[model samples]
Target: MSKKKLWQSISIVVATLILSFSAQSEEIYTQNFDDFDDGEIELGDGSIIAGTAASIQGGRLQLTIDGQGLGFSSFSIPPLEGSSQGFKITFDYEMFDSVGANDPADGFSINYGGAAMGELGSAEEGMNGKGVQDNLSFEVDTWRNGDAEQGVNISGYGDGRDLNQLAFTNGIILDDGQRVEGTMEISWYPGKGASFTTTGLNTNADFVDVETGAFTASDDHTFIISARVGGANQDLFIDNLVIETGAGGDSDEDGLPDFWETANDLDPEDATGDNGAEGDPDNDGITNFDEYENRTNPQNEDTDGDGLADGVENGTGDYDGPEATGTDPLVADSDGDTLLDGVENPTLPWDEDNPEKQPGTDPNQFDTDGDGIGDGSEIASGTDPTTEDEADENSYRQNFDGFADGTTDLQDGTVIAGAAAEVVEGRLQLTKDGQGLGFSSFSVPAIPGSSNGFRITFDYELYDGPGANNPADGFSINYGDAQLGELGQAEEGMAGGQAIENISFEVDTWQNFDAEQGVNISGMAGGADLQQLAFNNGPILNDGEKVEGSIEIQWQPDVGASFTTTGMNTNADFT
Candidate 1:
């Protein structure tokens, strides 16, 4: 599921107990606005625009003009009563003239309840007409006023004269003029609950639906659509308004109620025709009849509220798998991992129907493979989420066997040579002779949780060349806070200048004296002389022959560090 769907799913629930019955549907109100004169002052419903800044332009209800002064206008439909069955209100609207699309100063809303028509309640203040007692407003707020984020905002004024924001959308912005054109549907089941859905919004491929929990059924309601503008403004217009009240019966006996069909813009009297029970209006594979029976929205492809289409959920879409996900169609997150099923398993052609097949992460388990890192985190870190990495998520190991002639790219770092350094016999040869100064810096990304300390281990081989007793200088492993891919000339086993705070573990091959020989760990705190942290002299070489050994260095902040050598031809183990 997308971030938007994840947020909205918290409050939405499948309405399974909604009582369905048989009754004739009534279209109480509808206005296309095309019948009115281009610049008519009077609306067809015996109502006039209550605010002077708004008017009917080009046969459309122009709520606010672009770049115009503060605008607030409202008009009401004929009064209607609350029904025990249900009601649906739908309308298409657009905010254009791009000037203030991002933050349009203000926006509009649809208010329903006992509030009087033409009151223009808090419209002047960019509110849903404050003091509109016993009314609920479904508002589309463009401006971010105070603490409330912009988008679909549902607020209500109770009998106590108190106003409260009831619900809203999160991480969704519907302010762009190019894609803000949308259609809204308000479906209310009186005392049961209500759902507010918007389509063609900018951020989501599926409709954004917000469900309002149960509320007391109002006895009578006066519906009003209003808009406003403050210092900034955009052209806002409303068209194709529809409102239906009362219950609907299965007119054609196709398992779909008449009121449901009408509300979804389907033909109620036809069973086998277009928009009928057999028709897949949304093309989600599941027919209208299945949608009605399953309690999913017929006009929405993703009725389960995510990127997964309903057809895919029903095991009949683009997904490829040996077994199909039999997840409950009404459930959003099947595994309770705070991630939707579709989001956790986005890959196709799975060997199993398990939602966790893609990226080797299990949708059934948040931390697949029992790794401390979450599956999402592992996937993001370029690690196998389904497997427990021996080096953990941020750690990686690579042997430069190939790429002898080119750069070797590995997880967490890249092996790049500098001058004398080259890949020889599947190994990085930093220097071939005693005077051959070379350096190869592998850019290792700092692993997370490093404050707890980290360890580095590597294998090395050194031998006395022909006629040479031993290699003169030696190599060192350096770690420092410096630029990426930065290195200093290789000499005395140091790779960076003294100006950088660098720590080095140097192995001296040609010892000059007791103090200048053996193995030494030193550091430079930048702008200071090198300071020895530790030293140890051990049998790390074989006389006139090849010597092989492995070294391990572990460091922790404040607690200092330790160095250990293994498999060395020494009388005693070196630490």
Candidate 2:
């Protein structure tokens, strides 16, 4: 071959190699601090490391106290050419020392902009530490400032743009004072905008993704991982940084990629005004830009089919507030507790701590109280969701106050024993002048022997007999194994004929004998013949006249039984 022909072939081969390199994925930067000494870092490039208090320790960046009550540190990388296809930056971060402490101030961020480094200053400065224009920053705010704003924040800055501040109401995204370990990812597509994603940020989320709408992507950009602590103390650390370039493109310059726009029937060219990224035709309060980011349907209000609008569940758009649910928009069951977020809270701006419109459980947590039972189960079982506690499922209760309307009947399963027992004047009449005996029984499921305890309460009145000085046989409150309707003469209440082991509280109005007189609490073990009084008090009943009072009996398996009586005339020990 001739020399000119050989040169032509070599040039063609060189061009092909360059094309392949451009199309392929490449890792441009990575830092783990594995080889760095324990002290100030040495990046060797035109990198800036601010705050002398921080150092490279334990193969990670350890940032500690820099000032007396406030500390600040920042690590900035030199500008590098951005990939036209797409680029992804990932790193692991942790913040500690503010777990149980009060007022954990300031926070941390990962800033990408034209500036080489961020200004170590106020948290309200857009990026937590703002300095450059045409910047985009992701922040993890740890404290609630005077403006009543905290949690995770993502913002976009430009010269002629209205500062795009992504809305999120999860105050304090990182767990205070605890050692929180989480991964953060920043993906940038030139001319198409970027996305910020976080996983396990102690935010009770599997992952959270936010986006920046159509923005001018710079040809080259620098990075800064910065943190500040003011009016409180905290330690922030970072590790396992990786930056790479791969394939992604969005023709519309919206947050949604080209393929997604095509699939969703959205015009790729229409990203401005009111019909594309900024549009919310469904009126669910979530813009089309966010619908794409959340992988939800832009045309549907309840994209997850969970009976809740995306805005209500995600605390976005019109639902943004200090009391929003902060649940996942794309998921039906955000906490995976077998209950949908909509079913748990249902309304926007619901407080998990105190529910007013509905019995709102925490949509972000399965067990809101860290109890063994989930919030779904707690709500269903009528238990408190905000505290670790047990529920007494084996119990029965009845209130007679509703019966005062004279329209209600006895509660279901209530057993009335005897012809004289009836509901008259909105009260249970156990006995009348013509009838000598009556009984009312309520049987509850047996409680286990190794149980907490139980309580019984009652109110009674004895009035209007044939003679003013002579009342009837009186009444008794019984609990135990006894014949349901055993009524014996004028003496026995529930401890009458053929009774087994039981406890009976008897109020004797007739005073048949010395042993059977006064108010008595007796235990009938084998039979009525073997009954003995556990408590006895002198006569307190107003014979044939009005005498009203209440009684309470509490029994514990380990502590035995105790009794309390009210409105009794005699000063006697009922316990």
Candidate 3:
């Protein structure tokens, strides 16, 4: 092969290799902090060491506070790129006494600043004495006391001026049998300052607004895991130290980091600040996702649960039962009857007047009688339910006269007989006993359909009277005319008359000279006149004579007309 041809083949292979390497570089960054066993420093200070202290498994390193051994051990990595921004640091740590009694002279700190460990201040030295510059450090100190002036400085870097502190007073101490297990997280926002939270120490609190400038702009920073114990009497245990950048730890994706959630007793997986589990906590069968999305009670079986639900119980009135299969829990009864509350009784058929009795009560109760309806039905019909049944006529009836006109008589005999008569407003009234001897007259309206022919019937009696010296006084019927007196006049021997075309028989057994007749008059039109006749010189009966009777006059009105009566009986009575 020619040298030029060989070189071309090598170039082709090199291009393919470059492409393959580029493809394999898809991952951003990954670290579980489990690489300490290899005795290799992937990044950061080769001086930082790892070993086990208080536990079987080991992932801890130590740094002396005398400022001589392992000066500022650090772990460094490149920042995440693209729109995928932010970085987080998390770790677990414990503090203890090296010689068996509590030691107040030991401390440690984790710092992030520029890329070199030299940028981190010494752990045991006050912030003022350390030459560290341009950095943020969360220090755990066991020596500093109430001097808020020197512990965990937030801004300004030197002793007596350090603005933040996590002094001995703030450090958490475990009992003989207890252990400190906690996490600390620091999150860096692009344009915003760092935010952090610490647990198992002090108040186990969180804070933001540190003075490290903006974390996003400070790209190449080092992570230092360092500790110091002055006077050689303190020891510490560290486990589960983790450093993570980018996003997967937030299960809820709610922007709050996972470390903060664990420290705050909040569920990292729950976006709603409710329970952490994925589905309904009450096992009521509702999905937690749906509940959260819909703003419903994820733990409750019913959402609006007014005994009703969507798609089934609307407008049915049986809201208490299962969905559509049951009745609507609303309307009382759309049909206006007293039947179904909902379901099978959409058109309530049960009579409201006679509502169905409750389960154990009388089923056949009908509050209204004879109407074939119930009390509820009466109410629905707008009638009085309580008084719907017929009233007791015998108990309510009143007799105007001393005599009982039968207990069933709605009107007793207070109205008189053989006097002026008229039906006023559909009510009939009468006055008896002639006011002017045999010369008086009375009038009654012409009833409908009473023309061409009609009849009037009545009963009478004469209590006492001397036999008439001449012809007996009598009565007569007239139609649109007068002078029809003595209607086939009553002779002395005759007690009554036979039924005629429009006249009927009469009775006169009282012997008071006063008399009455059951009379029917036919062929009367427009108006009519009735008269009482006096036999030659015969006097009318006295007022002592009493009579009881009823009269009905019938007519056919080819056209409307009036009726009147002339000459009243001198003696008339009622009982």
Write model 2 residue lDDT over 1-575, tens digit each, in one string. Answer: 77744754564455345434653333256666665557846554445677755678877887555223546777877654444345678888776654455555567767766655544433323442243555666767766432245667667554323244664546555544556678888776532356677776555222233445323345466667777776566667789877666435667677566755665567777787545788887888888887765656777888777667877766442323324667666556666555666656534333445442244556666666675555655555566666777545565554332121111124333554454554455356666663333444333334554247778777766665544245546656666665444443333545445456666666666653345566666666666544545646456554445667878877666877666677765422465
Q: Write the candidate numbers in order of decreasing TM-score.
A: 2, 1, 3
Q: Cα RMSD (Å) between model 1 and the true structure? A: 22.1
TM-score of 2: 0.38
For model 1, how does the per-residue alpha-carbon lDDT over 1-575 read when each residue is reduced to its tens digit? 77644533331221111112223344356566664546665653545577766677765787777777666778676554434346778888877645443455566778766766676655422233254446666776666433235566666654422244566664444453443688888766532245677777543222223343222335366777777776556777888877767654678888676767876788888888656778998877788877765656778877668456776665332234323443434545443333465665534322233433365444455565664545544544556666676756556554444222222232234544454454455566666553333455555556676567778887877776544354555556666664556554333434345336666766765543435656777767754547667766544464466777788877788777777765544312234
Question: Model 3 over residues 1-575: C-alpha lDDT tens digits?
Answer: 77744754564455345334532212133333343433333323122343221112244533332222223332333332321234567666655443334334445666654335433345534232343443456665555334332234333232112233422234333332234457777655432346667777543536674434211223344555545544444445455554444433567876544654454345777777344534445454444444332323444444344332323434433323333424322222322223332222212343344434211111122332333333444444444433435533322222122111111111222222221232222223222232212222222323344445454543333333323222233443333322222223232211123222222122222223333332222231222222222222223344344333443333344532222222334222210
Cα TM-score per model? 0.37, 0.38, 0.30
lDDT of each: 0.57, 0.57, 0.37
Local error of candidate 2 at residue 494 (angstroms): 91
